[model samples]
Target: MTVHSALPDAGWAFTDDAGPAVTRLLDTLPVRPRLLGLGEPIHGEELFLRVRNRLLRHLVEHEGYRSIALESDCLAGLVVDEYVAGGPGSLDDVMARGISHGWGAFAGNRELVAWMREYNQGRPDGDRLRFYGFDAPTEMMYAQSPRHSLTEVRDHLTAWGDAGQLPDDAALIDDLAGADDRWTDEAAAMDPSRSVGSSPEAVRLRLLADDLRALLMAQAPRLLATAPEADRWRARLHARAASGLLRYHAVMAAASPSRYARLMVTRDTMMAENLLGIAAREADRGPTLVFAHNAHLQREEGHWRSDYLDQALIWWTAGAIAAAELGDRYAFVATAVGAIHHRGLGAPAADTLEGVLSTLPDDPYLLAGRRLATALRTADLAPVRRSDNTDDHGFFPRDPAHIADSDGILFLRDVPTDKP
Candidate 1:
């Protein structure tokens, strides 16, 4: 069933008014979602980021959003948050220390950070914008060792109360952790046999992590009472990161058939936890704008074909889990582009969503979720394009079935890189 001819008229109807376009899209949502997620089909494209920056400005200025969370390392994001909140630091240093995945070098990100700092200047603490990274510390190339988080939690706790109250096992954890190179071995990603997950040291470390987590929970009341609220919050963050990173490492070392699946799920689980924590900390004060890839923020099950494993794996995204927990309070707006000249992508096929959207003028627009879904269901939406080159690949199809799961769509008829 080719949708090339049966496709609905361009229902987006957005024109020169980008702000109003965004407003109309948000109005269609069943509820005002707290987490207003904006997903880019590809990464590091200045076009997408520029649109994102525009929409984010509108959301913050008009819609009362106070925080912006990215797909970078959650723990490392503290440096960014501090800078944005009026802490002292040069832009260059903040960008270097704050962003991960080597994204600090992005022109769009640099612009975004600079704008954030400028916007924050002279603003009261209550009015200052916050920045965050909701991703786990782990990356595709390396899963971070648990030492940092564990040590942080221990140090924070020790500062507030009796040092003896906490377990005295830093040396043991260090020994068990071994060299960072072992945990970061790229070969271990494909060959489970190469993983040290099943090693006796790893098993023991898991037990220790569980105990430490339990101890944190058990001692929370006392810890909170004795420490400043700020200190307590920081301690909790460390505890959660410590426990979560340990679990991630444990999964990485697993010899089970489901190791990879568990590993993916674990990463998203931690992402969800971090996002929820961000939401909880802020409460009903102000909305948050989350920036990530479409896969991480979409409500549908995320699928990726593992080149090494020779099979596809499906996992729940952070957005999917948040929707289950937050319901209508979580909203998502996925960005799709019609063309990316650098990546061999051209105009969208008439049957595809991008193609359908291409009929509109060359500008950023937002489409109603239900309307887009209806059009897609009738138009025979294209199949999803699974690839390892997600950062650079421009063409990605949207499964029509998942359209309704999103709150809205942000479409750009053409994507041009901001690179020199």
Candidate 2:
């Protein structure tokens, strides 16, 4: 077995340009934050995930961070959270059922959950770690039906049994929800005409969902008094996801040119809201680590371009939205890579950000985003260029504009096809 040691003070100071790799996360930003977003350029590769696991373990041990949130289904994550918090279930069951988007298949994620479970075995409540999913239940292919989220809200609020102004008939939700396949139909994503989003039943269901969510909030005080913290938090999350699903479907049903753009914006909006809720929940514990793609996590206008769309899609990223409200309480670290061998990518030209960073001795290192951006602006090392190496693969290179607003950056010189 390979032994991994995460010394708290291993790397924080970048002595000169491209010094030793940064190992600590807290002091990289201007202020200590409750939420720190760590972004990856692409998904599915275990290299970035292993690095993420290492960084998170370091933060948990040294920086007083108690939670780690992923870009997965929030509802599904509650199950993983329960498993890690010493609730009933085998590791295999939790991995298969609890995690969303097939992320459980990733060895690094399984390792992360196992580590968290093991770490929480005897720790005090305050010191124990928690897992969270901050993304919307929707996906690029299909948006899950609001059936589970809505029913969960109803069941939680029913703890009061006779709560004032709450939806009484669960049958109404079920009847309106109709069939699950109607909502999960992947074809509806591309063809709006087939979507059941704008139908009268859906519209009514949206209103009912809104009412149920409001009722949950109105009766929050009573629920908190009777229920545990986890139950109350999850009830609220279900409400949020239900409402977000309704809104996402509404947009998905639109036949306009900006349909996909609206979908992206709505998905990210749900993500930002989920993260904010997560921050609130973990406020009493300690800081949190939020991990996702660079586009979803950057503290700037999020952009997605395609040859099919007449115009590029643009909206605020989850990090940008959350940071606006969090102020100094939020920080971001974007990961950039020089090469991805599996994607047939190779060395970056000396003129790009990845190219210059690749020249450093460190295999993977952290740079203060602002200072790095400043240094690059003076053209001391090389003239910067927007990365073109990622045109083929989903992998993206760091842009000069992105670094200024970010707190720090984790850059890898090369990406091996196999797990590191």
Candidate 3:
């Protein structure tokens, strides 16, 4: 490895002039991925987001990628989509309401949103870019009330020239939802006693949500046939949001031993569905750029330790499922960082993925995972994993075995943070 430690000439330097690099990477791919996921090691890093933004632009301009998805609330992303597509809304309001998990405040996300809006200016609908959030609307801190999604579905149906076909009571969903506090209780995440998932109201709501979902699906053909293409898409989104939120609420109210795991899996499952939906709608238009954490986008099984439960949790990620379903049409590039500020992470020790990549004399670069893994094997340096000592939610270990499963790896030597 030392022989090739001086950064192989095959990798592309991370810079503003990344169009050629992206083109090369796309051309070199054994299979064209309809969903090209760019995974980040950590969140809130401005550099990572900006780099992703640049790459997305390149894919859109050159490779004809039409959609950009992120690790954000699927329902909330509608506001963002509307804004980017020249809808009525101020940037501040869109940032506040369109983004979830408090990510809208990040300078990187703000810049991306602004640039997307600017890019859409004067572009025809066919040439315009679409923004989407692939995560469930609920958060780890507190799940949002399912009222918005449920009511949105009802309202859309009512306007569809068939209010009589649905439930007569406008207050039915609100009444069933009850107080938002019941679902958003923070302690319920770990303590079964605090959860109301099995409550009678919740059970009833589940049944009703199911009925509503079935009704929407049954009527979809007729509704879609009568409406314009855009209206049809909007109607489908409303249906998805309603059903997805109901399912999320049902999970939130669960009091089982596997509640947390179910929630985790459910969130990712929703993400996968949303992604596939986008692919179905826009695959003909272009590929999609999915920006998310490595854990959510990796093809390998995801691993994490829960401090609340004092045990490890492992599950399949959205990317893995997509890869399985899409076959070679889903490509993933996991980002590995060598150092981070505030978390005390610095120059990775040799033997680790970061450490091995750090040997290459580049601030940032893209390495073909298989080639890099081969080089590591040649140098007799086994790739090591990162430790889970810090409480950083963005941190995850990159097992070397994942190289065979991944299309490429985006390596950053250091992460820039707001440390003074």
Candidate 4:
């Protein structure tokens, strides 16, 4: 069967090799989303990042994509965005300060930013590419201080907001924030008692965060009239970070059984909001390519289990939220990898989705979501074998059920993590 044609009867046949021919696969999607999400099975894999760069380059050249959003810090991304848009700064400097969660250390990310900058040389604004970091600044067991976001929004209000609506004393926010360690304490994640979120000062800060958000909205007309695009974006970004951190801290202080569940849900909610904002901003320019973990971008409810949690937590992911609102305008393409020998991961079991794809000659094959799921299933959906690789590496195997949940799947025979 040709790559351009539909699935065959004798088993799935390769068509496009997940290269520039990815355009063919994307053209088959039901709708061209303003935000096209590409999810990876794990983070920090050089191969996945490189593949994303390649696919996005193709999309920019062939499909008119103008922006790329990553799972890094939204606030930190602005620096990278500015650099890519011809702002002054060396690539090394931008990589260190512009990317969060230590993702800048990855060579692949540096290449992506450098390429975006090079691509923008002498190009007009509309045709030049854009960059964004959509994930909240929260981690599994560590959440950052909300002081910067809180203070930034507060400053914005003082500069533009009406006096009567503003906080009585601007310094109060700084006082309430107390110390950075109170919020950044790693122990707070596993033990809520260590959190200062429910303290009197922290509660006041939460209320202040809410007030700041409302004030920004109420004064949007005045602010927008006076503020430039960058100012407006920064104000909104600060507002989002402030609000998200307050909510996350509140969860951290709760000694309830659903602590981790609430934390995970809160983090993804922030991601979803940022994604929606990106969609709105890029609606006129062109489509965007969002890259993140498979769990964050899948349309199905996110589920996780660990010794820390008593029950299996199921919550809506960013993709589910975006899909509910954007409908056909949001599409998810999941990447299924065959093996990463370096991580002790071997070839996929013949019964698994990755295993089935390993049988094909195409190193990377683009398969239809629903059709492939049906073809691979006999009676009920057989579970995709969970990775036998050590858990410390953070590898997640394809959940057979999720293959049908996605709009498409890009299967790779090997990630070449050992590097050629």
Query: How high is each candidate's TM-score?
Result: 0.89, 0.91, 0.92, 0.92
- lDDT of each prediction vs. the true structure? 0.75, 0.80, 0.77, 0.81
Q: What's the count of clashing pairs in each model shown? A: 1, 0, 4, 1
Off by over 4 Å in 4: 1-20, 307-311, 377-381
lDDT: worst 10-residue window of model 2: 1-10
Q: In model 4, what lDDT does residue 299 have?
A: 92
The alpha-carbon deviation from the true structure for residue 201 of candidate 1, after best TM-score superposition, in angstroms, is: 3.2
Candidate 2 residue pairs in backbone clash: none
* lDDT tens digits, residue span 1-420, model 3: 254653575467766778876776777687778999999876777788888988988888888898899999887898899999999989999999999989898878888899899999999998888999888777875666666666766766667636678855445888878888887888876665676666777677666666666667777776776656666566566566656666766666666667667777877877888888888888778999999988899998888777766767777899988888998899998888888756667677776667777877666788776666666665555645554446564577578766757678888887766622
Q: What is the model-wide C-alpha lDDT for candidate 2?
A: 0.80
Query: Which of the two, 1 or 3, has more TM-score?
Result: 3
Ranking by lDDT: 4, 2, 3, 1
Q: Give candidate 2 misplaced runs (Cα > 4 Å).
A: 1-25, 168-170, 308-310, 380-393
Clashing pairs in 3: 1-379, 197-253, 197-254, 351-384
Q: For candidate 4, lDDT tens digit of each residue in 1-420?
A: 432132333223333334445665566678778889999887778888888888888888878899999999898899999999999989999999888888898988999999999999999988889899999987667887889898898888777767567877556877778788889899998788999888887778888888888888999998888777678778888889988988898999999988778888999999999999899988988999999998899998887655335578888999999999999899998888888777777887666667666666555666768767666655343475665654643566668776777877877778775532
* lDDT, candidate 1, at 174: 75
